[model samples]
Target: MRERDIVGREGRFIAEGKVVLNVLLANPAFALESLLVLENRLAGLTGQIKLCPADVPVYCVARDVMDTIAGFPMHRGILAVGRRNDRRSSEELILAMPDKALAVVLCGISNHDNMGSIFRNAAAFEADAVLIDETSCDPLYRKAIRVSVGAALKVPFAREGSIEAIVTRLQSAGFEMFALTPSGMTSIHDAKPARRTALLLGTEGEGLPKSLLENLQTFKIPMSANFDSLNVATASGIALSRFSRFSGF
Candidate 1:
């Protein structure tokens, strides 16, 4: 199971923590294969276990045994394997949203922690969906799911496309794309919301590519001159919050 830390199992991800496990068991969109719980945790999770599909097995193991099997300390004492049911394309997902939509678009966000926190922010701000480029890390990666506090599972997301193409599609679908960068021309607060808006974010150090930045309207969070930049996740939270308020997210 620890191997999942490196490469997740095909079409499946490991969910940790009582909260994440509860999300896995609660969402019909995900199908649980099995649950491994510490013997001590089993009694507390009995209600959740009964809600699992009859075919799905719940294994109870001693704390030491669970730790040994997990190849780590396994402090949460709760892990579950699950697969997603709704794997929609980016175009389909975008098309399904309301005319006025708020979306978070990511480019070159390879850090799993950043990816997770972005998802959490997107969920917190009630983004209609998150669109990640082919270069971004998998939002469903185990550590990402864990770091997101299960928001990775809650937010709708799609990946695998050129950043340019993704931007074009969003424009074609009536979304006004705003590239968020430190050097952006307009302050995020001053930018008016469109019928549908896509907030494009990039890795903190590099920011968005110049070509993409030139192609779309750009906005930035107004900050003191002392700091060069905000963490990509933190920037996303601020931008999404502003956009969500305007878009009625």
Candidate 2:
């Protein structure tokens, strides 16, 4: 199938590379529909293939055939169709978190790289889950999953509703929400995060909406005076790292 076709499939997404395949095989949140591997790469993937449920199909194809099917040179030589099995709503996901929890919330995050990087950081720092707004790109998008090095597959996430509604629900659930913005009132170091915390991030150029920023307790990363901003993904890593450290997660 073409890249777009794979990404556009309902409920299913393409998981590429052996590392991602390994995650897909192990993660109970996703179900493996099938696998497509380069014929020569099959032997190397025996362990991963063995992890697949007996009912899941595995296809081995020639390099040229795989390349033509993918609409590009298939360097990774491993691909799987994975369906999201645990599709929780934002409220359901939040309600499931432990009393002491840390979450990353996204608003209008349209870039796949940023989405993937944020999920990767979330996984690295042991964030309980990621809650995405309606405007954000799907974390399960093929390129995003690839960029995350399979963290997107492993991390628990839910995408639903508007940012305002999601924020309101988080507040109702006793979560202290912190919006990360360049003009944030409190430096991240000075802010006191609660036992249950949710870090809110926005689209790269616009950042969080001014109205949203005004209501939430906001935090900013201390940076060199010359630069006012960081890439959303980099900013997430920095913010999550700091928060995770303080929260002792």
1-249, model 1: which lDDT tens digit per residue?
A: 455553445567888888888777767767888889999888898789888889998899998888888888999999888888768889988998887789889999999999999988998888989998999999888889998888888888888798998888898899999889988999988988777989999987777899888878889899998966889999998888788864554
Clashing pairs in 1: none
- Candidate maximizing TM-score: 2
lDDT of 2 by residue, 1-249 (tens): 665666546678998899888888788888999999999999999898888889999999999999988889989999888988897898999999999889999999999988989999999998999999999999999989999999999889999899999999999999999899988888988877788989999987988999899899989988887975899999999888878855553
Task: Tell me each candidate's TM-score.
Answer: 0.94, 0.96
Worst 10 residues of 1 by lDDT: 1-10
Q: Give the TM-score of candidate 1.
A: 0.94
Cα lDDT, model 2, residue 71 = 83
Task: Please count the clashing residue pairs in each candidate, in the order shown.
Answer: 0, 0
